[model samples]
Structure formats: structure tokens, C-alpha cells
Target: MELGVNIWSFIDRILCWRQPCACCGAPGRALLCPGCLADLPRLDNPCRRCAEPLPAGATPLCPRCLGPRPPAFARVHALFAYAPPVDRLITGLKYHGRWEAARLLGSLLGEALAGADPLPDILVPVPLHPRRLRRRGYNQALELARHAAARAGLPLEAGRCRRVRHGPPQAGQDAAARRRAVRDAFAVDGRVDGLHVGLVDDVVTTAATVNELARVLRRAGAREVSVWCAARAGRTSGT
Candidate 1:
């Protein structure tokens, strides 16, 4: 089995060798060139609680997510820090209607979480309000979740939750402001009773949004919730 896996990996590498790097225009590179891959700002050392970046050899949890009134979600998992090229990737999918970008980002997150010790039973994409959905023509989170569910083989439940309130964007909001912005923002529409749910989103900043969703999910009978984002912004996002 090991030898067969290695052989297939070698063949895949050969096939990918001819594709251009996604971020850089480097020729004859795989999904990303080696340099871009190394510089991707991977959150390999994340807080066990919020998935925030931690110093090498530091404790498992971040100070912000440590205090009382802990998050409704069990934990967060992510693949990258929301930095330059990574930000570009997210924005491309979010604003430019780039479906391929969603495919790349979602597949990356899904594959990373595929080997998670305890995977969630269902994946739920954060919903967009009806007005925003009509304006944007699609829910970016759902787009991301579709590819993630396909890659990870996790069942996706899109209608379980809905955004009942459409407030101002959470961008540029501090933690307190974010908490306020998302207050009563979500409503549970379908049954999630006694299930472990993986909340899928494009990015996680202070986590105010997902935490609110988790809160609603729990009230709707979710056993546990965890966040899975393509990227995690730094402390500057009010983390």
C-alpha cells in the first residue's frame, strides 16, 4: 500500500510539474511554487482554542480565547494566516466571482481537515442574508463549502441556518464592535440536534461571527461546533 501510494504521488507530482503556480506566475510549478508554498503564512502552530498564531513552543491557547464565557464552538482550524497572497486568494473568490479560487481554497481546507482526529458530522456554511445573496448572486461561504464537502466527503447542510439580520459589514470592527454587529444576526432554521457541526467560512478574524453562529447552533441543539476557515487573520483583526 505504501509503495503504491508513493508511486501515485510521484505520478501526480509529474503531472502538476507543468502547471503554473497559483500565486506567482512561475512556470513548471505545481499548485504553488516551493517559495510561495513556504511563504504562505501557514498557521501550523495555532491556538488549540481559536487557531490564532502562537509563538514557537508556546502554550496551546491564545490569551483572548482563554477567559471566561468561552466560545460556543469547541475550536477552530485553518490553513493560512490572512496575509498578502492569501488575502488575495480569498478576495478573488469573494469579490471577483472566481469559482476556481473557491475550489482551490476549499479543497485546501478540506484536505487539511480530512485527517482531523475528530471530524464534525456535518458541515454548515455561514449564510448570507437574502438581500446580500441577491446582490452577490451567490453565497461565497456556500461556494467554499461545496468544494470542501466534495473533497472531504463530509455531508453539507446549507439550509440549517440563515442570516436573519443584515447589519453593516464586520470588516474593520473591533472585538466588541464585532460582537455587537453580529448580535442576533443568525437564526437556526433546520434541525442540527445532537450533532457535531463544522461551520465553514472563508476567513476567521476575531471569530465573533462564527461564535455567534455557534451560539445559535447550540441553542438549536447542536452538540458541538468548530470553525473551519481558509485563513485566519492576525491579532490585528481584534483577535
Candidate 2:
């Protein structure tokens, strides 16, 4: 057991290349080069409600959000639209234990939130079930949130929320299925009354996971919940 733990610890230390731009293998640059960073599929002029990418100067709210029913979370802020290098970086940190990916991606998340008008009072990383946490040895969301919270000058509360359900993997699942899988799956354990809570996650696809989590946080007396994801993803056919 000790040997296995040590092996994973080592793996976690070098999940991906630190310098030389992991994506294009260009030397001298950091994990991501400036050219690649500029070309990344970022969300431009995103909707305030869902963070859906919109045309420049388009309406602040998307047509869907203009409807009567909105989401449980008040807003979503995302840096990139889940694609290509961003997806690879996230996958490396999430599955292969690449600590550097978290450093790079988390720093980018922090940079994006640096000048926000209203930042959340506290950062709460979406929890992973104990089973997954033990298997992975770290929560990617927490790792990313650590950097973001530091840059944003906010407190990170990793223990505020807990995931009790060990649902099947959510990748490629549509919104409705994900909704069904995560219903009542989360429990809030900390005091959040009147506090503007920021929920951090690695990726947002269909927004089902964050939405369910927001419901739980609100029930626990949070003033309002906002989601901050490193990337916004498009729903897949199904995994």
C-alpha cells in the first residue's frame, strides 16, 4: 500500500511537461505558448447567465436564459470553450495526474477572474466521491481552485461540499441523464449563509453537475452560487 501511494505521488508530480509548451513542443515557452494561447478556443462575450459564447457585442443574456426559468447558480464564468489543447490539459490533470497542468490552467483561471467587478466571498471546489478521491489521490477542482483562490484573493473551502453518490462516469452524458444521476448527490457541510459562493470545477458541459451542486448550496443557506469553470464543454453524444 505504501509503495502504491508513493508511485502515485511521483506520477502526480510530473503529469505533463512543465516548460516548452506542452501542446506544440516549442522550447523556451512555458506549458502553453503565447501563440497557442491566443489561438485557443476561448469564449468571447459569454452570456452572463450560462457563460455560453456569444458574438462580440451581442446581448448579455442568451435566448435560453431570457426564459422564465433560469439555473440554480446565478452566473458562470469560464475561460475557454472545452476543446483541443484545453481539453488535453484538463484531461492530463484530471486523469494522468499532471500537476503542472493544474498550475498552468489554474493560473489562467486566476488571471481571468483578477479584474472581476464582484468576486465570490469564498471558493468551493466541487467535491469528488471518496472512492474517486482515493483513486485519483487529488481532486483536480481543488488543485485548480487553490491557484485561482490565491490569485483572486479569496478563501478556498474544499470541505464545504461533499459528494456522497458514486454515480457512473459523467463524460459524454447529456444534460438530462446527468441531472438524474446527480440529483441529491451533494451535501453542504459548512456555513454559507449570506455569502456569495464561488463553485469551482475543471469543466462545465451541459452545466448539470454545477446546477445540482448549486441547488444543494442554496439549500444550505448560501446567499447565491456562481460557477467558475476552467473550460466550458459541448455535450457529447454519450459515453
Candidate 3:
């Protein structure tokens, strides 16, 4: 069962690459087969502020984001839910040395925003801690940002934001724990006054990392900061 699931998931992720449709086994050309693309879980009714999946017939803002303390970032745009093929693609890019997955994910994000207006002035890929960077040999976020920025014809500003503190992986942490773990982990090295910046990443779980980085950017004079991620884990109540 597990192996079948993994194989299917792998096929689903082919939507972002120029390969045969994993689902229909068609000629490889586009990112995904139409049938498979239609099967992917898309977040249509997302929170206006944070882009969390909204409940059926719920308001634009999630309860957690509607609480007194608003998020630092202006908005979030994610392509898919953090499940199945999407999750597999992210994991493959980050852990399995799959650079093609990064490029494909980034391209998908770019295409999603093709017709949108008021695009970001700069794209900043979330930074990795020096230790982690050495271990991974590359920051997955940076690779994605490069592709997204190039496709969108936007400036890609990397290395301006640095991760100063290395925290434990956020895989098992709850909302509060995730917040605490990332709190003070980032620092802005240059000015971004009045700039509309977009922060790119592979996945958003609790959104703790992007929030902390957005806070830093705001403090450094950024006028706006938005998040662009490939997937979001799930919705969270206002906490």
C-alpha cells in the first residue's frame, strides 16, 4: 500500500516538469496531465491575509489571523495543499538532491501569478543557517526564488536576509512551539525601505519562519512583504 501510494504521488508531481504524464503515461511535454492537474487539491477559499484554507462558507480571514495580533506579512499565495505529490516534490527537492523539482515548482508559481497585477518589486528566498547551508550544500528556497524571479522578470535579491540562529526542524512542532523555535532566527543585512518584497519558500507549515522573516523585513523599512510558497500544510485556528 505504502509503495503504491509513493509511486502515485511521484507521478502526480510530474505536473511541474516537462515529462510524461505520470497519470496517463502520455508524451512528456508540459508540467502535468490535465486529468492529474484537475485532481490536485487547490485552495480556492483561502484566508485573505495569510492564505490558510478557509472552512466551507467561512469568512475571508481565518479566526487565528483575525485575532488582535495580525500577521506581519501582507498576504500569502500557495499553489497547492501540502499533500501527496506536492509534499513528495518538496521533499525530493530539499532532501533527495532533485534540482529539477525546485525548478518545476518555481515555474508553477510563476505561471500562477502570470495574470496578477501589482507584482512584487523583489523576490527574497528564505535563508538557511550557515550550518544548515553547509550540510545541504544549497538552500532550496534560493533555487526556487531564482526560477520564479527570472520567469516573472523581477529582481531576485538573495543573501540580504540571513538566518543567524539554527533551530530544530519544525516537522513535529505545534503552532506555539513553531513560533518560539523561529523567533529571532533571522536578520536583515541590507535596506529594503518602501520596497514590496516577496519571500519564496517550498512549504508553509505553521508559517512561523516566514512570519519571523517578515517581521525582520518590516523592521528594516520594507513597505510590504508577501509569501509565495508551493504548498501550505493545513489550516490553523486563530491561536
Candidate 4:
């Protein structure tokens, strides 16, 4: 029965005309073509602390994050650098109204989490403020989390965290400025005692937002926290 369903789904996808890759009219599943996927600007080596792509042979932590570590326990994993095809993929999901991209990005995130040295107990996407949720109609992070959770077979805690404050977008902000903007922004919605939580996001920049969120979860009694993001900006490492 499942095989029959799978075959039907595959055929349906091949016949569907509405959902083709914008970059190349591929008949089946893909936001970007295989050729485009190969051309994506990948981060070779990112900072261990903040997951920012770094120059070749640079240290693990960027100077800023090293000076005063961000609030999380340790380590961040990013699938790609915030440039070119990756940047365009993220932009399409966030702004151009392409939600299906989350499925593709989420699958990669799930694979990365699976390879982590220590796996987390629960997956939590960074919460969107109520106002932003109303405007956007869907939380991209949450959508990504749902897809990743399905792929990884990890439990997803959608209601475990809440955004208490809504602020301007973090674009163009420096590290310190971004930290200040997101401070006290998140609160755990339920018990997290001794739970190892994996936080998901579409991108990580200064580590400010995730740091602030991890602090909240820790304060709520979480035992450990790690971050998983689809893209990282600014620094790099060989991992």
C-alpha cells in the first residue's frame, strides 16, 4: 500500500505544473536545479562558537565571540554560508513566498544534526513574535523545524518556547547591537528540566538571537542546548 502511494505521489509530482523550480523548470521536486545546487556558495570553515563562515585557516571562533562567549553551552552547526544560491534560497522562503524550500533546507539540517557528536532530546524552532506571525502568516523557523523533525525522527517541541517581545528585523545590525535587540526576547512555555534541546533557525549571524534563546531555556531548567541553522554568515572552519 505504501509503495503504491509513493508511486502515485511521484507521478503526481511529475504531472504537477504549478510547482516547478523557478531557476529551471524542473518537472519534479526542487526549488533549485541540481546544477544550481552545485553552484551554491558553501561555507568551508566556520567559527566553532558562532557558526559564521571564516577566511581559510582562520581560528574557530571569530574575535568578537571569543572575547566574550555567547550564552549557549557550546558549538553551532551550519549547512551553508549566507551567500549566492543559499542566500537566494533563504530569501525566497522568507520574502518571496516560497514555503516549500523549508522542506529541502530542513532535510539538510536534519542530516547535520544526525551527525552531531551529541544529539539533543528535543527540537525547538526559534519563536516568532505574535505580530510578526500575523504579518508573515507562518513562522519559517517552525516550518523548517517540522520538516527536520520528520526527517530526523526527533521530537519537535513547537510550543515549548514563546517570543515575549517583537522587535525590528536583525538585518544590518552589528554583533553587540543584535545581542541587545534580542535580549530577553524568548521564554520557555513549558517544563524543560534536564532536556537537551536543539534550537533551529533559518540562519545564524551574530549568535545573539540563539544565545538569548538558550539563556531562557537554561533558566527554565534545560540541561543543555545546541544550535542548528541552515546557513551561517561572516566566519568559517573546516568541519
Best by lDDT: 1
For residues 129-170, write the lDDT of model 2, one tens digit per residue. 999999999999999999898778889999999999989988
Q: What is the lDDT of residue 120 in candidate 1?
A: 90
Q: What would the TM-scores of all predictions be?
A: 0.86, 0.86, 0.86, 0.86
- Per-residue lDDT tens digits for candidate 1, residues 107-199, read 887897788868899999999999989998999899999889978999999998999999887787788888998999999987788999999
Positional deviation of residue 234's Cα in model 3 after best superposition, in angstroms: 1.0
lDDT of 2 at 94: 94
Clashing pairs in 1: none
Which ten-residue region of model 1 has the weakest summed lDDT? 8-17
Q: Candidate 2 versus the native: TM-score?
A: 0.86
Q: lDDT tens string, model 4, 13-126?
A: 664435666566675466666776676777777777776767789987777667864557566778888876677778788876666678779887988777777789999999
- Write one digit per residue (lDDT tens) for candidate 3, span 138-191: 999998887788678788989889999999887777888889989899999879
TM-score of 1: 0.86
lDDT of each: 0.85, 0.84, 0.82, 0.80
Q: Which segments of candidate 3 are over 4 A away from where they belong?
A: 1-18, 22-25, 235-239
TM-score, prediction 4? 0.86
